[model samples]
Target: MIAHGSLILVLLFTSPLMEAFSQPTKVVTLVMFKWEIKEEARLLERRMLYLHETLDVR
Candidate 1:
């Protein structure tokens, strides 16, 4: 429980900095960007559940 609590606290403290760094770049278009994804290897999902318009089209 303490580990989770401390993780939450750390996330809360650095959220703004993380958000600034989390902005999406190299947007996917035509479904081909999966080839050049830079962040991670999984379909690329946002964990915050925010309604962000990526403006990407396939």
Candidate 2:
């Protein structure tokens, strides 16, 4: 019973540290997603410009 209680205490103390470690992973994922979106937007813009130029030439 005592061991179980101690284990619970350990978990309680460590949970916040675990959460803190995970927070940065979430931020990194968000930043990476944002960059991916920006890159995709740039690619789309380039494609649109190419299409516009092709249409104008025709």
Candidate 3:
């Protein structure tokens, strides 16, 4: 009974170590893309021009 209990304790402690060694390493990559805001700026300028034209067209 003592041997059986010792074996069980040994197996339980070793299982987690075996699992860590058996798994492959994982690589994680974070990618970010920067987009130019020129188009948005042009759109805002056009809106401002339209507002100016409406106010000045009278």
Candidate 4:
């Protein structure tokens, strides 16, 4: 019973530390994802403008 109680206490303490360590990674991934989305959008816009310019020239 004592060992079981200590194990529970250990888990309770470690879970928050684990969450703290993991939280920044989640934020970093979200930032990276947003940046990638913005880059893709800019590329698509550039491609569309290029297509329009070529069509206008021809």
lDDT of 3 by residue, 1-58 (tens): 4698899999998998787666533211111111236666788999999999989955
- The regions of model 2 sitting more than 4 angstroms off are 1-13
Candidate 2 lDDT over residue span 15-37, tens digit each: 99899999999999999999999
**What C-alpha root-mean-square deviation, in Å, does candidate 2 show against the real structure?**
3.4
- Candidate 3 local accuracy as lDDT? 0.69
Better candidate number, 2 or 3, judged by TM-score: 2
Candidate 1 pairs with clashing backbones:
none
The segments of candidate 3 whose C-alpha lies over 4 angstroms from its true place after superposition are 1-36
Write down the lDDT that model 4 would get: 0.96
lDDT of 1 by residue, 1-58 (tens): 4698899988897997677666543233524566557435433555322324444345
Choose 2 or 3, whichever is better by lDDT. 2
Q: Residues 1-58, candidate 4: write the lDDT tens digits.
A: 5698899999999999999999999999999999999999999999999999889863
Model 1 whole-model lDDT (C-alpha atoms): 0.58
Worst 10 residues of 3 by lDDT: 26-35
Q: What is the Cα-based TM-score of model 4?
A: 0.68
Candidate 3 versus the native: TM-score? 0.35
- For model 4, the stretches where C-alpha displacement exceeds 4 angstroms are 1-13
| Top candidate by lDDT | 4
